[model samples]
Target: MRSGLLVSGRRGGSGRVVGMLHLRVVCPVDATDEVLAVLKAHPGVTHVALFPGAAIEPAGDVVAADLAREATDEVLSALCGLGIDHTGGVTLEQIDTALSDAADRAEEAAPGEAADAVVWEELLSRTGEESRLNATFLAFLTIACLLAAVGVVTNSPVTIVGAMVVGPEFGPLAAIAVGIVLRRWDLVRRAGLALAVGFPLAMLVTFGGAVLGSYSGLFDRTMVLSAHQVDFVFQVGPFSLIVALLAGAAGMLSMTSAKSAALVGVFISVTTVPAAGYAAIAAVLGEWAICGMSVLQLVVNLVGIVVAAAVVLALRNRRSRTRDLGRPLSNG
Candidate 1:
């Protein structure tokens, strides 16, 4: 049996976190099917898929191999346990060697530390294109934002948090982070357009709903200028920014690590959409100062997510490279 190292990573989708891994191994083509079967038995892996390449094929001098995350641990164990002469298996030492080497190479290839990558045009485009899921998300975000606005006016925390959970905006935001990392310009565009359009749509719907509520006697005049009375008021302060940063970091980490996405509920608690919802209400009610605060809150949260995602991806890339080459520096 052959053995080598595997490094785990992430690939972002519209609302779900995607996992990726790179493996370095020496094994025969005839046994390739057996090798893959063994790897697929691991618990920590999901979305087990393969990308074939000539560079790493083991047989016919092809020098290529790939195993999915589901197969990770078992595959490593099999590699270690196998009697055949080959290279690559899962090990802490192997992983460390790969990551250290990648960091050094990246430092050299980059003119400077890799500045945060933002595929602006692509981001805008992908968000604009309509998809069934994205359209549904848009509708949900509108309803949630509207509900949040009402909750803020009524000074109801429960309603506000309910709106936050119901808001589907985070999915697209996560997609944008993923698209950036994968260099998937199409997805980037889709996510960007969704954000650009979704926010206004949500604001408009909520504003109209607020007006209707006021006319219907369900909403009172006192509610118009309401700010702190609302449970949804933006938490303004350094801590607010800090929370955004931490949430962003966690969100990105969830995307890159194993089973970490289960913590997405924690990220939703950061209150990004709720803040936006509140700000929109302020605008409808002509509360300029409150609106300003809400806007600031949203901006901070957005920046936090993007910045954190980029940092995590950059680190993962470096780590992947180091593992693949078995060195602290790329041959380049």
Candidate 2:
């Protein structure tokens, strides 16, 4: 049975009206088409996705009647006509309650927690069905990490930032966190393996490049210990952890949100690669202090990303549960 439904609406106002409507309906897959047809008839509905067993919950703030009465009435009439039950009134509280309920059920149907860690595996399973594990992705990762290492060695903020924009490691890490929470061993294994294998390889390759640069006169003592304007260094306080935490959260949001993936690149810029490059440079120079700082930076980023992803997924799950509790009608 389908576990949730989401319906959304918008209203026009005297000045400029911005309205959003979302609904969650729980029904079996066989009945989904009928339910979808009914929902499609509602006005001002922009997007609707159907996940048969996914979690759905009510979302958004309650709209004030003074603001959305006309649009609200039009939506109410349409819903009643289709035999799709919905609460009336344009109060913001009511709207929030309604949408939240729908979203909860949607989440219950397909929990993402267990699947989080195995993101690569899941991606492979999904895309591999259509195409082979393209070498392009791996190559890109390697190149990006190498560039970031170079950026650190040169103390070039621009190069390091560029490398961050190119790094694609966050997705796999997020998957691992999700896998860990959901106790999905497969996902955990895939994510863990990717991290274990990919991380060291990236570090090693980048280190080799740094060594070559040292031999080639590209690296110097000042560059080795110098922290870029964009790089986070050791002897640092809590701020590094905060940045990592926020970046981690944003990364997860980008992954789950269809329209928000664009922000993921920025998130990457704030984490991981720059620190990696710094570590490689420190190692090549035998700068213990700098190496320690770089290692701390890396650890901070890794922990922040993992913790943030896990917490965000867990919160989403809880909200979905709340919506399920509030939904009154049974989806047949």
Listed per candidate, the RMSD to the true structure in angstroms reads: 12.7, 12.1
RMSD of 1: 12.7
What is candidate 1's lDDT per residue for 104-188, written digit by digit as tens? 3322433211222222222233333422146687788898888788778778878887887787665566667667766777777
Clash counts for all predictions? 29, 50
TM-scores, in order shown?
0.59, 0.59
lDDT of 2 by residue, 157-276 (tens): 778778888876675677666676566667667666666666567778888988888889986877655554644644445887888778777766555432245565544546576677
Candidate 1 is scored at a TM of 0.59
133 in model 1: Cα distance from truth in Å?
7.0
lDDT of each: 0.56, 0.54
